[model samples]
Target chain A: MQRIRLLKDRIARKLMLSLTIFSGLIVFIMAFGLYQRSRPILAIKPLNELLFSTSWQPSSGKFGFFPFIMGTLWVTGVAIFIAVPLCLFTTIYLSEYSGARLCKWTNPLIDLLAGIPSVVYGMCGVLVIVPLIKDHIAPFFGTFSSGYSVLAGGVILAVMIFPIIIHVSSEVFRSVPAELREASLALGATKWQTVKHVVIRKAMPGVIAAIVLGLSRAFGETMAVLMVAGNVAKVPSSVLDPAYPLPALIANNYGEMLSVPLYDSALLLASLVLLMVVLSFNIISRIILIRVERNIR
Target chain B: MDRRYAEEKIFRSLTFASTVVIFLTLAFILATVIAKGISYMNLAMITQTPKGGYYLGKEGGVLNAILGSLYLAGGATFLAILVSLPVVLYINIYSKKESKIAAFTRFSFDVLWGVPSIVYGAFGFTIMLFFGLRTSLLGGIITVSLLILPIMSRAIDEVVRMVPTELLDASYALGATKLETALKIVTRQALPGIMTAVLVAFGRGIGDAASVIFTAGFTDSIPYSLFRPAATLPLAIFFQLGTPLPEVQGRAYASALILTSIILIISVVSRALTGRFTRHVVK
Candidate 1:
C-alpha cells in the first residue's frame, strides 16, 4: 500500500508539472503566431515611416500607422485624466469613510459594473452619449460636431475603467496598517488629513499600479471605441474631430484584407503594436505591485 | 490651523461627490438599458430564431444568438478550467515560493491577462488561416479560452496561496503525500474561489464581441456542430444596432438586456456560493 501510494503521487506530480509547462507554451505560441503574421508588413514598411507618418492609404499601399497611434494615445490619455481623480476620490470615501452597510451594497454594485459587457457600453454611447455630445455639448461650445469623436470614445472608456481603478486603489488603501491611521489621529490629524498624508503616501505605489492597469485597459479597448470613435484614419485636430484608434483600425479592416495588397499584414502589425503596449504596461504595474508587496512584508 | 481645516472640509466633500457620481453612473447605465430593452422584449423574441429579413427589420427572434453564446462561453470556460487547475496546483503544491519558474509563470499570466480581446481575435485569426480552418464554434472556443486562461488561473492562484501553509505541514506530518494534500485539503478550501473565477470568465466570454466577431462568423441559426459558425449575444447586438431601422435598434437593446441579466445572475450566484464556503475557511 505504501509503494502504490508513492507511485500514484509521483505520477500526479509529473502530470501537473507538464501541465504547467503547457500553459507557458500557449503564451509562446500566441506571441510566435503574431510575430510570424506581422513579419511581412515589417519587412516591407520602413519602421520609421510606419511609426511617424500619418498617411495610411492601404489601397495605394501607404501603411503609415502614426495617426492611429496618436489616436490611441489621445483617447487613452483623456480617459486616464477623467478616471484617475474620480477613482481616487471614490476609493478614499469607500475605504476611509463609508460604514459597513454602505460598503456592502456599493461593493457588489461596482463588481457588477466591472462585469458589464463592452458592447453594451457601445450601445449606450450610440444611443445616449453621442447624441448628448452632438446636440448639446458641441453646440454649446460653438464647434462643428459629428458626435462620434475622440471625446465620445474617451468618455465611454472612462466609464468602463472606473471600476478597475476604484477596485485596485481601494484595496491599496485598505491595506495601510490601521495603526498608522490611529497614530495620525492621535497626533491631532483629521480623518481626511490622515488619509491624505499617511494612507495615500503609503498606498502610492499600488495606486500607480492601478492607474497603469486602467491605462492598459483603455489602450486595448476595441468595440466601444470603434462604435463611437468615427473610425476616420487621420490625425485629429481637436477632441471633437473623428479619429481611428489602433485596435479599431485592426478590427474594422481585418475582414477586407484580401482586397488590398498588404492589408492583412498591416492589420497584423497593428495587433502586434497593441500586444506590445499592453504587455509593457502590465509588466510595469506587476513590478510596482511586487515592490509594494515586498515593502509590506 | 484654519486653512488646514478648510482644506480637510473641501477634500471630504469632494470625495463624497465622487462617490455619488459613481452611483449615478451605474444607475444611468442600468436604467437606459432596461427601459429601452423592455418594450421590445417578448416571448417570441426569446423562443424563436430569425425568420426572414431579420436584419432588415422584418421579424424573428434572438434564440440562436442566446443559445450560441451559451455554447461558446460554456465550452471555453470548461477548457480554461482544465488548463488552469493543474497549473494553479503546480504553483502552490509542486513549486517553491521563490522558484524562478513559478515567478515567471505568474508574470506571464499577468501579461496575458492584460492582453485585449481584439488582439486575441487577431491572433486566432492568424492561427486559423495557418491551419486552413474557417471561422467556426471551435475557433471561438479556442480564442476565448486563451483570453480567459489567465483570469481563471490568477484567481485560483490567489485563493490557493491563501491556503494556510500549516495545513500542508499538518497533512505531511500525517504522512500524506503532496498530491493528496493538494487534491483533498487545498481544493476543498479553494472550491468557492475557483467557482467564482469560472463564473467571471463565463461572463467575460459571453459578453465579448470583438474577440469572436471574426472568429465565430455570425450565423442566424444555432450551430449544431463544432465546425459550424456560431452566433453570440454581443455579435447579435452589434449587427442589430448597425441597422438603419428604429425597431432593429430596439432589438439591439433587448439583446443587451438579456446579456446583462445573464451576467447579473452569474454574479449573484457566485457571490452566494462564495459566502457559503467562507464559513468553512480557516481565516
Candidate 2:
C-alpha cells in the first residue's frame, strides 16, 4: 500500500510538471511570436527614426512616430488628469462619509461601469458629445475645426477610465485596516483629518498604482479611441485639434494593408510602441505596488 | 471654538460635493445614452433601411447584424474556454512547488497579459492570412481567444490564489495526490470565481469592436460555418456608421445599445458573483 501511494504521488508530480510547462510555453510562444513579428521595425535604426522623426506620410514612405506618440501621451495625460482627482475624492466620500447602504450601492455601481462596452462609449461620444461640440463649442473655437478633435477623444476617454480608477482606489481605501483609522481617531484626529493623514498616506502607493493602471488603460485603449478620435494621424496643437493614437492607427490601418512587408512591419512597430508605453506604466505601478507590499509586510 | 465649528461645516460640504460629482458623472452618462438610443429607435425605423446618407435618418431592423454579432462573439468566447481552462489550471494549480522553473513559467503569463491586444490581433492576422482564413469567423475566434486569454488567465489566477492553502494540505493528507486534490477540491471551491472570470472574458470579447473587425470582417449574413465571416455587434455598428445610407446609421445606434446592454448585464451579474464569492471565502 505504501509503495502504491509513492508511485501515485510520483506520477501526479510528473503530470503536474508537464502541465505547468505546457501552459507556460503557450504564453511564451504567444509573446515571442509577437516579438518576432515586430522585429523588422523594432530593430534599432528604423525604430529610432520612427520615434524621433516628425514626419508622417504613408504615401511618401515617411513614418515618424512622434505625432502618434505625442497624441497617445496627451490623451492619456488628460484622462489621468480628469480621472484621478474625481476617483480620489469619491473614494474618500465612500470610505469616510457614506453610510453602509450608500457604500454598497456606489461600489457595485462603479464596477458596473468597468464592464461597459467601449463601443457604447463611442456612441455617447458621437450622439451626445459630437453635437455638444459641433453645435455649441466648435463655434467659439473655429469653423474648420470639426467636432472630432483631441478634446473629444481625451474627454470621452476620461469617462471611460473613470470606473476603473474609482473601483481600484475604493478597494485600496477599503483595505486600509480599520484599526489604523481607529488608532488615528483615538489620537484625536477628526474624520477628514484621519483620512487625509493616516488613511490616504498609508494607501498612497496603492492609490497611485490604480491611477497608473487607469492611465495605461487610456493609452492602450483601441476601439473607443478609434471611433471617437478623428484619425488624422497627427500631433494636436491643442485638445481641440485632431490627432491619432498608436492603437487607433494600428487597428484602423493594419487590416487594410496588402502583404507589403513594410506596412506589416509598421503595424508591428506600432504594437511595440503601444506595448512599451503600457509596459512602462505597468512597471512603474508594479514598483510602487512592490514597495507598498513591502511596507505593508 | 468658532473656527473649529466653521471648518467642520466646510469640510463636510466639500466631501458631500465630491460624492455628488462622482455620482452624477456616472448617472449622466448612463441616462444620456439610454435616452439618446431609445429616442432614435422606433419599430418601423428598426425594421426598415435608410434613404438619405448615413446619420441622416434611423432605418432598418438590425436583425441580421444583431444575430451575426451574437453568434460570432458567443462562438469565440465558447472556444476560448475550451482552450484556456486547462491552460489556466496547469499554470496556477499544477505547477511544481517551490521550484525556480515554476517562477519563470509564471512570469511568462505576466508578460503575456502585458502585451497589447493589437499585438495578438496582428499575430493572429498573420496566421489567418497564411491559412487563407481572412475575414472569416475562424479568424475572429482565434483573435478573440488571444484577446480574452490574458483577462481569463488573470481571473482564473485570482480564483486559484483564493483557494485556501489549508484545503490543499487537507486533500493531500487524504492521499488524493496533487492532481486529484486540485481537480476535486481547489477548483470546486473556486468554481464561482472561475465562472465569473469566464463571464467577464466573454463580455469583453463580445464587446470588442476593433479586434474582430479585421478577423471577422463586416458581414450582415449569419455565418453557416467557421469559414464564413461573421459581424459582431461592435463591428456592425462601425460598418453602419461608415456607410452613406441614413438607415444604416440608425441601425448603428440600435445595435450599439443592444451590444452595450448585453455587456452591461453580463458585467453586473459577474460583479455580483465575485462579491458573493469573496464574502463566502472570507467567511
lDDT of 2 by residue, A1-297 (tens): 777866876776676566556656764465466567667656644667988787876655677888888888877777777777767877788878787789878776776676677777776787677777777788876665577777778878888887877777777777788999999889877777788789989898899888987888888887777777787877788777777888888888865455554667677667766666676777677667656756654
Global fold similarity of model 2 (TM-score): 0.87
Q: For all candidates, what are the clash counts? A: 0, 7
The 10 consecutive residues of candidate 1 chain B with the worst lDDT sum are: B274-283
- For candidate 1, give the lDDT of residue A240: 89
Candidate 2 yields a Cα-based lDDT of 0.72
Residue-level lDDT of model 2, residues B1-283, one tens digit each, is: 5675576667777777877887787777788666656755667534433333334543345555566666766777787776556656655566655456655555555545555566667667766766767678888887887777767867787777767778788778887866677667777788888889888888888887777766777654456787888757776677667777766666677677677778778877886676565433423
Interface RMSD of each: 1.4, 3.4
- Regions more than 4 Å wrong, model 2: A1-31, A40-45, A140-144, A259-261, B1-12, B39-60, B96-115, B130-132, B271-283
lDDT by residue (tens digit), candidate 1, A11-100: 988988988887877767877898898788889878788889888888898999999999998889889999999999999988898876
Please report how far candidate 2 places residue B8 from its true position, in Å: 5.2
Tell me which residue pairs clash in candidate 1: none
Docking tier of model 2: it is acceptable
